[model samples]
Target: MEILRGTVAANAKPTKPSFVSYVTPEEIKSESPRPYTPKTVKCPHLLPGEVMFCSANTVVKETQDDLSQRGVFGTLLCTNFRVSFVSDEEPTEDTTQLFKNKLYGQNDIPLSCVDHIYGGYEDKRKLITTGSLVKNKCPSKLIFHCKDLRVFTFVLTYSEEKDAKMIFQGIVHHCLEPKSLKNLFAFSYCENTACPEKQRKQRTMMFDCAEDWDLDMKRSRGVCRLVTENNNFELSPDLPQFFIVPTHVTEADMCQFHGKGLPMWCWSHHSGCALFKTSTLPLLPEDTIAQAYMEKMLTAVAHNYLFSVKTEDLSDTLPTVQDIQLAYSKFKHFFLIDNTTDFWMSDMKWFSSLDSCGWLDIIRQCLQKALEVVECLETENTNVLITEESGSDLCCVISSLVQLMLDPFYRTLPGFQSLVQKEWVAGGHNFLDRCNQLHLKDKENTSPVFLLFLECVWQLLHQHAPAFQFSETYLTVLSDSIHVPVFSTFLFNTHHHRATVLRAESPHSQRDPLNCPTVWDWSVQFDCRAQDLFLNPLYTEKPKHVKSVQRSRPTHQRQLSLPTACKTPPKKGFFKDEADSLKKMLRVKRISRWMLSPETPHPSSATREFYETWQRKPLDHHGLILPCLDGPSVRVWLQRYLRWIQEVQIFGGGAVTVLGKVSELQGEVRELQRRLERHGGSSFSSSNQQQQRAIRARTGTSTGPQTGGSRSSVRMSSSFPFTTLKHNWSYKPAIPTSVLQSLMASGNLADKEDDADPESIV
Candidate 1:
């Protein structure tokens, strides 16, 4: 080893635990010529091509064990890849620099292993101290959370303060680097070398999604204990066009197994073809209209696409042709029962077990399945249509999720609110029955389907924090308002219902707080549960005002940097103002239409009033419109939505195409390697390094699965041709057929036929 040790004053014997070291205050002062000037350490053990960032005099502290012991004084080195520290123990010449001194023991940590870094003084902490109490310089320290769930703390004093800021910023910058498939799969060092087995397992799990799934085996085994613990509900039989929602698909799929309203889209290939979600016919035999409507809907789906799925289940108790009215009746009763239990029991002692609730489980299952359908449509470029007994409950959930996932615009606050309105509210997800069950009956056959949907959306908001405008608190309050009877959720089944209720009431009544409650009323609830539900852990506060840091910039540049209309705060209670504006716009449009055609008979007063009253307000803020939230929330939502639009509509296609190219390149590289192994060296042998580098550049593929070794590191090409990709600034961008069909291939088994007659069950 090439060792470069710094001068040390003491010759104390090394301790049993090699990492431990002790330095007295007098010794530390003697080592530093100036009290404020920290001794910098240059690491001699830097890996090949590793660049040193900065170094400082600090103390190494172990966080996990020996909590009461003081930190060991040392010289810390920060590099592009890792942080290393050298403690003072061995004696050397006083004239020699710290970097030349002999060290007792070294502690090194790789940057890739770090999960989070705290600078010790966050904005929230600074706000707590009054101006008089606040110090000119706060104590500097760094806290690191590692991927292995280990914590590291380093304390800095005197001259080390500046180094703390630099090191903290450097670590954060490294963490914020654009993550790729390779970085996600990269192996980390346990001590000094990589952990291979752990990396292999994680990478395998990631690739498992592409592998063929055995639904029957999982069903027979009852593989997931969580699913078996809940209920004896059997998995839906694998129909010709649709598969059962599997219990063992992923660990996250635990809460969503064997629940009702679970028809799923079936696709032989991931082509951007119209999705066919095959489901059981309705359970009720009273009415045949739903069945007829289903057939007509299926026909329309088929007519729109060249190839569509047809469901054929061999063994199942569900009816083939269901009656809509009776099916809806059962749905309504079930929904009501579930909602009542959730509303009451959520505040009760049994709230912990709510995840296992049969109704909640069904909602979770529907949401999970719906997300799967959406992934197929959006990421995989497949079009999907759902089929269910009444084509309402689960159908509504799946379709809503599909729309939200596929459209970047829907991910915005107003778009999300409008999505709920269009899907659950207007699309008829049995809100009336659920509300009636919650309001009228205390027990039996109630469901929390709407609340479940809210939770599902919350999950998305949690995962993609930037994509949502409203907080979890907003959703929780809206749900609680259903029980309170004042909010629109209780009195109105849909937007139309709410509009009707509003129009019927006098303007004076609408203005009063008690008489006319909007969704905003939920925010005023002071209950512990209400407060808890309102808090969103993932909401990132954006800077309200941008600072002009550069005064010397050109006039035009400064003008451009000024906050745009989107950034400007709207008037408070903007929803009310917007609503009034919409009403006026509708009236003007009506008047213009009347003036254009003089020969048309004059419309009735009631007809004119109804048109004016019932018209759906135009969606603004980039086609997103949140109901109760103000401009700030909507603005935050809009920012996220616009970014999402750019990602999905503009950059997303290129990523997909790149992914396809990478997949092809990997296959080619493997084939060539196989050929090289079988035969003697050829012309390809000379270009092997180039080929391997290209593969690594494109995909983060491992060199050998058995050893879990990588051939090359991930290389992110900054010049990736994003500008060459076609751009669409619209909220809804058109998808090309070729792009959609690029990755389509048949991997699933062919559809099977059933012995049971199609219409016999109903």
Candidate 2:
């Protein structure tokens, strides 16, 4: 594709009209541009593929390693439009239902209908902790609610550490002309004699053609192409030409976009921005963390100027810290609030003194420069929602107090560690302590903010003031005022346990691809979240990802105490008057003094009522609430985990012991019977005589020997014989004993019936 000097390849022949189509280089060289010191280029308006003069797009490398492309995609926050609707406050069931119904249009918005989204910030004058303004600020939202409304969103995202911000707000305002359908060099017929394939696709895009700017030239930005355009390029001509348009626009000229011959045209939007800020600290007295606080303050303060949808690069014109502080010094006394110039202005007066009182007078003379930046907003009917910021809201108020206390430093000749800068040693009074002295003021009847201010001031004095016994007392007073977080979220919450970066090969390394652990210091953040708010210290074994521990929690544990009496609002929202009865039931019943008196007292109706009331929810109860070390409470609970494990061990051990004992008892019984059988009628003394008699009688007859004392003794002595004889009628033990002779002498039968041969012999 070939690029012409200024006009598209619409001419049939080098017609006379070619002279009238575009401004020539002679005309460009003759004119000068507006609002410029540097960074301004000659505005070019050439059609794609027609090369003429000024090698603007010729690829070139610069002084720095970064290739500075002449054309990079950028956002322009220049649009201004309005739309109105009701804003829903908190997301409610009914509100959600309504939102769903309204999300899609009941009918299409015709090309004729025009819609918009624009907002502005107000001079909140929120005194910040820092003396500096926030950096890389973006606009906050104020949504619009309507019966049939839908909004397309654009976001610019990047990291402060990386010094980058991707912006996408400019495309909203750019208009695409709907009339011109053809003549765009889409796939082209470049009859340029310089080309082999004379008719080819031209690189001059529709967006680049109208805007006269190209952004693909930036290395970080990579490649991009126009997504929405009509396909209409003729591929014939007996002549030659080129196509490749420049991509950039001057303030005076707007883009003339390609169209589809309809009432409207479509343009795709995309963007991002990268900035380079030295990784070095710039403050003379303060540290980096303190500097970050100032940046936040600036963001909160300069909310309005940043609301423009067009994302413009203001880094070139942005003032340095010193210049900004000077602006504050100049503008401080001009605006009045309450009866005083206020601490912010007073600090401004001290930190950066105006060269002359006249210069100061200009500030005093001016009405309100802060408001000038903000007054563009028109609130929509949409509901506003509030969520807690990631960091402490309490810190914001504290920072303002510190700034107020440091006002005197602004005026001192040396100025915020100038002595340290000169001598390389800290000598001036500490800024942290100097700022906290404001707490000495009487705090009675102070507003919430005023009370917080007093607390913040007191704390600073305690931290940096001369070591004194009174400081602890001041701390006690401060503790009564604010509930500060225990740990710093940035230190512990974002980074790894240790401060060193992890390498992949080290076993302790946290650089596993799965976790992508950070190398930041996590101690401050961990302790703050753990020991301060929640007692379980946040322990991270692997920097890549910290696994959360789950302690068994009671299902009905009461989180807070309930109110003593009912004071429900008529139409309270969900959070305003939630159920408190459930909170009371979780508390354990306690034995009161009345129940433990010296004498047993008779039951009273009131006592019964008290006991019945114990049935109420824990939070609903009125007495003996647990106090936390900080604001969040530590719940005391009894765990049965260890006891359950012990019980299982004991039961299992006892069962095995009992089974063994039973087996041993059975074996012992068998051994005793065997011994008795082996003994028979021998190995016995006089006591054995009874055993012998019993054996002789039992062997003779089953029921024959009804024993007297001697026979019973004999039968009792024979363990095995007794057991066997009870169940069966056995003949004899192995031989008859001499005790049988004694029984016969006593005139006992002695089983004569079985001794037939003996009787014959007798």
lDDT values, one for every candidate: 0.37, 0.21
lDDT of 2 by residue, 560-678 (tens): 22222222223424312443542232221111222334563432333333233433535321111111111111111001111111111232223123323433453465467568957
Predicted structure with the largest TM-score when compared to the true one: 1
Q: Residue 281 lDDT in model 1?
A: 51
After superposing candidate 1 on the true structure, give the runs of residues whose Cα lies further than 4 Å from its correct spot.
1-293, 307-364, 379-382, 442-445, 494-517, 520-762
Q: Residue 341 lDDT in model 2? A: 19
Q: Once model 1 is optimally superposed onto the true structure by TM-score, how far is the C-alpha of residue 340 displaced, in angstroms?
A: 26
Q: What are the models' TM-scores?
A: 0.28, 0.13
The parts of candidate 2 lying over 4 Å away from their true place are 1-313, 316-318, 321-374, 377-762
- Clash number by candidate, in order: 22, 63
Q: What TM-score does structure 1 among the candidates reach?
A: 0.28
